[model samples]
Target: MRNLRYVLLAGLLGTALSAQADPVSYKLDPGHTMVLFSWSHFGFSHPVADIGITDGTLVFDEKNPSKASVEVTMPLSNLDTHVPALDKHLKEPDFFNADKYPTITFKSTGVKPLGGKKYKVMGDLTVHGVTKPVVLDATLNNVGPHPMTGQQAIGFNATGMIKRSDFGLGAYVPKVSDEIQINITTEGSVPKAGQQ
Candidate 1:
């Protein structure tokens, strides 16, 4: 009876340790992260815009990928179209209305692993006071220690598309192109002990 109890305790302890080993928490490294969007400009060329991320977190579990999730918040005021006049126009009531909305956010609802390091992430994205479902096709770029910082890091590249009209940003419509293509490249690092 004593031997059986010892074996059972050892098995329970091992199971607990294994369960804790897979999921890793990482904080978005803002300086090394980028979110950019491009849209057709009346058949002339594709114009690009930059949206800066305020903060985010990603929880990834390699062993059990279904448990992974990500959440990000972006400041609307940080949007840059590179053209001053156009940038101002985007903030007006006709477009983003930065003063009213203030920020945009995304929170994952589900994750589907597409074989190897690729995943399809379905999430709720809020923009211009409107929330809609969005899907991102993401690829894991790298996951390891950073050479410079020596901290555990993970990198990913993702692409997603959103229709401006769906989010109530329908200004020029067909002329300016309602569909915007988003491209994101980000690096996140594991937080130190006791840190958020």
Candidate 2:
């Protein structure tokens, strides 16, 4: 009976060790992260827009990247589309309604590894109180030590598209291209408390 008890204890310990072996954190270093969007215009010229991630957290266990998670928030009022009149329009109620929403957010639901260095990351994106599923085609750029701080870090590129109308962002419609393509690049590190 003692031998059987030992075996069971060993099995339980092994399970705990296996779970702890998984590395599961990615930090979004805002300095190196950016989000850009571009779309076609009224067949005359192409217009583009871009924003930066003010704050975010990216979590992952590279060995089992399918369990990864991500969260990001951006200031809608900081939108830069290269046109003042259009930017003003975007801030109004018909568009982002910046006065009410203020910020846009995203949180991951599922992560699927496609192959070596590639993945499909899906999440719920909330803008103007509307939550919609957004899929980002992700690529693991590299894993190494950050040159500046010599800290362990990883990089990734995520790109995807969503219809503007889906988020109640329909203002110009056919004239401004409902399809908005996005590209994101991010880097992260572990947190050190007592420091903001």
Candidate 3:
């Protein structure tokens, strides 16, 4: 009876440790994290813009992927469309109104893992002061030791769509194509001890 009790306690402790090992917190590498968006322009061309991440964190669990979470922020000030005039126009009140809402953010409400390395990440996206639910089809690219930093690293590629009008940024609407396609590539790593 005494040996059976000892075995049970050990089993419980082992199970707890295993569960705790599933989740890992990763600090997003700003230099490598970016969001790219493209929209059709008057049925003639598709123009793309790039936005770099300011700061973000991701909590991921490979064993139990549904337990994963993500939070990210990108500054509108970082938006660039490769066209000086358009860049300036996009920040004006007629568009993003960067002076008022300087940033765009997303916080995941839930993560649903699909077969293999794909997932549907549902989150609330805030842009131009309006918040709307968005879903990103995300794929885990890799998770292992970083080649450059030698630290544990993870990377993912995700794509989603949003309507500019829904966020109140509908300056041109149908002419500029209200729907925007967004592509995201992010890389994160476990921070080193004593590192910021």
Residue 183 miss distance in model 2 (angstroms): 1.0
The candidate, 1 or 2, that scores higher on lDDT is 1
**For residues 13-70, could you state the per-residue lDDT of candidate 2 as single tens digits?**
9999988877656668878888888887876777777777788887778778898899
TM-score for candidate 2: 0.86
Each model's backbone clash number: 0, 1, 0
Off by over 4 Å in 3: 1-8
C-alpha TM-scores of all predictions: 0.94, 0.86, 0.94
Question: Would you give me the overall lDDT of model 3?
Answer: 0.94
Of candidate 3, the 10-residue stretch with the lowest lDDT total is 169-178
- What is the C-alpha lDDT profile of model 1 across 85-136, one tens digit per residue? 9889888888989989889999999999999999999999999999999999
lDDT of each: 0.92, 0.85, 0.94
> Candidate 3 residues 1-196, lDDT tens each?
9999999999999999989888999999989998999999999999999997998999998889998999999999899999999999999999999999999999999999999999999999999999999999999999989998899999999999999899998887788899999999999999999876
**lDDT of candidate 2 at residue 141, scale 0 to 100:** 94
> What value does the lDDT take at residue 70 in candidate 2?
90
Q: What is the Cα-based TM-score of model 1?
A: 0.94
